[model samples]
Target: MRLGWYSDLNKQEKRTYWACFGGFTLDSMDSTIYALMMPVLMTVLALSKSDAGLLGSVSLIGSAIGGWGAGMLADRYGRIKVMQATVLWVATFTCMAGFCNGFWSFLPVRFLQGIGYGGEAVVGAVLISEAIKPALRGRVAASVQSGYAVGYAISLTVMPVVFAFLPEDIAWRAFFAIGLLPALLIWFIRRLVPESEAFQQVSKQSRKIDLRVIFGGEHRRITLISTILASGIFGAAYIMITWLPTYMRTVLNLPIASTSGYLAVNIIGSLIGPFVYGLISDYISRGRAFMLFLICQTLVVSVYMFAPVNMTVVLALGLLLGGFQGGLASGLPLAFSELYPTQIRANGAGFCTSFGRGFGSIMPAAVGFASTEMSLPVAMGIFAVSSYLIAFIAAMCLPNATGVDLSDHPASVVNEPSPTEAALKKTPAVFR
Candidate 1:
């Protein structure tokens, strides 16, 4: 197959990719500030560990709702509109979070921010998948998705510098207000991005949202397997990203600077992980690439959890864990896109991924609750091992997409209704 040159992408696809990437990167930056500032916030607000955990859980729940709703909206209104709306929503709320006077105010603001964050990922993934060529799609999507890690790295670098100069009370709020910067990207998106061609073709065929179809026949098996796989992977990811810094600080007894340094190293590994997996998935089978990463993740997470707490050992383990986990972001978009047809691609990916995200949200809180009773290392180890089991199940159940042409599948298999069936059945419910 002839690979299209980057220059060959019509202006619209290029614009869509960059806009989606920028939005997602900013979304990561906004969401990560809270994790980076968790310790400071806990002390400043005089909140308990459980309370801190609640804040994170509530945000995840909000994101779950946002992603679900945004997926449907993207299907109905077009990806560009949903993408623009979500970026504005998250940016405004994230800035508001910085100004909150207390827990009550912060909770609601963060919840709203979560909605924006959730919508960004779903919209971004769908936009990129639709715009890029099939052969290059995995790598391009992974590159766009890697913006999250880039944003995360920026937050880690900026936060300490800002805190060093300003008082904690003022500095933290300032960090959050920085989220507003992404809203500026909306102008670029408005100028450049086009409605996805795939989305446009599907929309002309059907405007209804029939979510129940996801559970009928062959799709039911794929849906269940995808949900379980996504839940386990995301659960592990959320726990790792949200609480690992605190774990480094409290459990390993590292200073703030040292913990940040370790996290920086870990994130570098994360930045590399996706690109590597994207390459492998392009040349090899997507399932094979995912399986390889899943095995590595299982091993890395176990070692990171149970290893003796020396600084060098911990840093090494953290790097490996970040790399393995990072590969999932690359694999998931390609895997899920291939699983369903173009019509319902956003909905299928959003529902399975966000729902899994919702289930995974429980892990961080569970880890926090377990920390009150058991050792942090033991609690983390349990979460790590559980993912291995989930990976095994996914490996067994997910279909191979090595030679599949997405366009050949009935759009309803993804999200579009068959023209013939339009006369016979009512539209499906949009599962937001």
Candidate 2:
């Protein structure tokens, strides 16, 4: 009975939903493995705090470029092909990092890995959004993004077990080597996933990649606002993930084991958040739901920064803050797809998300630098405040997407040009 029900659902939805979820899950797993190894790597390499931060920044820089590049490729080629290639690219580079002899060798390898990481989000999100039914798009997209939280939890659980038996020098290598496992998934993805029908229908009509289209009259304001909004979310998220453990250890005086436990709890909260927000967005307006989450995040993060240091309070705050912020992962993908037409959908989403990735690259180091002069809480408090402010601005500027079917929008507006339509107009068919 259960199998029958799932089969029915699968037929009704599309393979792209499962494909994006699986790809994102592996992407998250690969990224978190490196994050978990950061402290160990720092100690083994004798890296200065600044040098360690720079390594992270380089990866984000790589991802920003990858994101923009992948989006363009997806529009020119197809989403499935681009996604499969990105997974393979990251997995190959990540495995190579296992063989690095020193920090210098590892730095370049990690930057290359970032390129794959950057491309995954843009490709995966557009693929899923375009393939699924309009009514189910928000929920399904949220579920896909939620796969990241599950991947992070799996890394946290497995890393400790891997470390227990292995020495430090070899353990990092083992983690990197495990990253290669995702490469095998490319074969499955290639076999199972198909190009989006919507993309195919639209691409037949328009073959050109027009830069002027994105910055032209209708899209310019929305594009700029989306970029700013993504920057705020990415900046806050990267800084929190990178520096939160350090803050817990240095400021709260928690042992490494206890801090790991707190992080595990936070990740659990993150796992739940996207699904909850997805359901809520389906019932309420996406914009309203986003604004509510941001407002709650503003209050919760401030309390988290300045609250008294009891274990119970800290754990509660960590869970709430993590959950609220993680909701952004779900919201942005759906919002971006709805904001643009198919022709420019991939590019707009890619550019906005990647631009944010570039800005986000500096946030962790900025937090670390600020901490040297100001109190840890003070520096983090500023970050929390700025995030909420920007989120507020984004919410205000964002157009309401509630209950609108993207297919109803004009093909030229969204970038979907039918082959017949192109032939009628004597233009070449675009890549589908």
Judge candidate 1 at residue 298 and give its lDDT.
81
Model 1 misplaced regions, further than 4 Å? 1-12, 203-205, 407-432
Reference-based TM-score, model 1: 0.90
Across residues 74-118, which tens digit of lDDT does each residue of candidate 1 receive?
877888888888988988998888888778888898888888888
Query: What is the per-residue lDDT of model 2 for residues 192-297, given as tens digits with 9 covering 90 to 100?
Result: 8778766776645474566667676557766787777777777778777776776787678876578789998888778888877887887875766777888888
TM-score, every prediction: 0.90, 0.90
The residue-level lDDT of candidate 2 at 248 comes to 80
Report model 2's TM-score to 2 decimal places.
Answer: 0.90
Against the hidden true structure, what lDDT does model 1 obtain?
0.76
Off by over 4 Å in 2: 1-14, 101-103, 253-256, 408-432
Local distance difference test values of all predictions, in order: 0.76, 0.75
